[model samples]
Target: MNQCLAKKVSLQILLVDSYDIALNATAQLVKTQYPDGNIISTRTANDAINKIVNWQPDLIIMDIYLPEKLGEIAQTKTGLDFLQQVMQKYPKLNIFVQSPYVKRLVQIKPAIVKHQGGFVIADKNVTSQEMLSIIDGALKGFTRIKGITDIYIYPDIYEKLNLKPEILKLLSLAFNEGLQDKAIAAHICVSERTVRKHWETLQAALGIDCHELRNQGINIRVFTKIRARAAGLID
Candidate 1:
């Protein structure tokens, strides 16, 4: 590879997080690895993306949720236009997009690949060194990983709420428009009361009163985003 292309191996990275502590933790983690690589940390994707445009980092590591702008939707740091620019100008650019929720990553994968980015498939329990190696591999032009993804649930919320693995499957069922509780219960092969009880537990765990969150938005589509933000997805 040419000097400029080889330099991309040590390319800087940007991180956009809505939650203060998570953003700082992630920035510090990256600094530990690439001590000299520019780490553009910000509170919003807009600012992060702008810095990406200027600094032109070879990679970006972003969590899905943010407030003020990213709000409930855990959008990519660089929106579609910026993604297009990345493909055009920095075809070798790497992106590691993560969320606390695996379902979110599954849903968002197509979009990530559209921008030529990859996912980290390791379980959250993996060591930080293992996770860093996943990121390094991506920068080196490998997209396939046998383990879990890098998107971690911010430790703040992760510690607060211990969600069951089944919740996401149940949520995927609930996100359907016009799906009644009875139908969801049937899908889960549980009684309606059981379904309601689980949903209640989910609401309580996230520290959001279900009725209140539901009151704010009638559309089921926003529930994924809402649950994520409620889980403190700033990192």
Candidate 2:
């Protein structure tokens, strides 16, 4: 939140999909094409919005038909409604809604502008690069070089530093940006001492000095995630 931090800020993109296959393919394409850009996706609209608020992504790639919960029963919600909320609160954020529900978007064009959200009405059949283009036009506002594929493709970077999931999650939570170790431990339902043991194992595997990995949680996390992605471990 520092002024200096804002000066060096990069564009963020959020992909919201209720379905995993569509979300993962889109995410992989986007991230593969533009690695430097902080592109992230979530299955839950709430979690999507949470990251949107925290990361302030310049664009949102959204889909319809969210799982719903009404008392004991679950219902459904539109991804557009979620987009509308983003527009209301973060009008500057651009959006590209990709759904088979193009007719609904045509019906609701008025709402799109009312919320000040941008649009790229995409069918389920749209190609990956076209989706990339929607994201491309928005990044210019952030003063980044357009259409240069800024995403970091460092599979070897992750490959060089292998780690397990439990340790990976802890590193992402605690090491990156110095999140509290106690909080990370609590989230994993383990003690701080146990977390340290995991760290020790990671240190041994990566050939990193224990003290260095302890301080560089984000780096450790990135390596772990890359390795996981390479191994296709994510669901």
TM for candidate 2 is 0.50
Encode model 2's per-residue lDDT on 1-235: one tens digit a residue: 6866865675577887777798888878888877766778777767877798788777877775454322222112345456667777886677666665544332233455454445555666867777677666554432221111122233232332343447656655754445676787888998989877775665454444545756766566556544433332221
Candidate 1 lDDT, 113-223, residue by residue in tens: 554554444433457787688778766656753322334333333333334445544665665334667988788788999877766656665555556657886643356
Question: Scored by CA lDDT, what does every candidate get?
Answer: 0.56, 0.58
What C-alpha lDDT, on a 0 to 100 scale, does residue 86 get in candidate 1?
45
> Candidate 1: where is the Cα deviation over 4 Å?
1-10, 68-91, 114-126, 145-235
